[model samples]
Target: MEVWDRALTKRVDPIRYDAETGLKIYREDQLNLGKGGNTPLCPFDCDCCF
Candidate 1:
């Protein structure tokens, strides 16, 4: 959480996922990707976003 907050400098609302990466959450736009892992990674450089 600290890493993400430092990188993004904004609060995040993450959707958890179970995968080889462990805790995974794909950041996305509601219109473009529809959220979740199905959505592409976020444009931000935040660790959690990736």
Candidate 2:
């Protein structure tokens, strides 16, 4: 993806996860306290990720 090629400076082996398994990726403090911090990000108002 262009994001991987153009944005991140650190090399990372990206992992792909389906719906049930995808609940584990997060953008650090992207989540609130007491909640599962590893929530996946979805586009605003978009259902495509679901």
Candidate 3:
């Protein structure tokens, strides 16, 4: 299992990430865990991780 699996199994929290970019975003649970959400969209136009 992976971190995501453990998180899911223990119901750790909700996580949201961008499909284009591999950035780990946070817009679900905050106080109890990870940080907050990222900008709706990326400001840069990088082809690697837009």
Q: Give the C-alpha lDDT of model 1.
A: 0.44
* C-alpha TM-score for every candidate: 0.26, 0.17, 0.26
Off by over 4 Å in 2: 1-9, 23-50
Candidate 3 per-residue lDDT, tens place, 1-50, comes to: 11332333443333766789866564434322333234454334322221
Clashing pairs in 1: none
Residue-level lDDT of model 2, residues 1-50, one tens digit each, is 21122233443333444588654454322322233324444334432222
Error of 3 at 20 (Å): 0.5
Candidate 1's C-alpha runs over 4 A off are: 1-9, 30-50
Task: Give the C-alpha miss distance for residue 11 in model 2, angstroms.
Answer: 4.0
**Higher-lDDT candidate among 2 and 3?**
3
Q: How many backbone clashes does candidate 1 have?
A: 0
lDDT per residue as tens, model 1, 1-50? 42234344655555666677677564564122422243344454322333
lDDT of each: 0.44, 0.35, 0.38
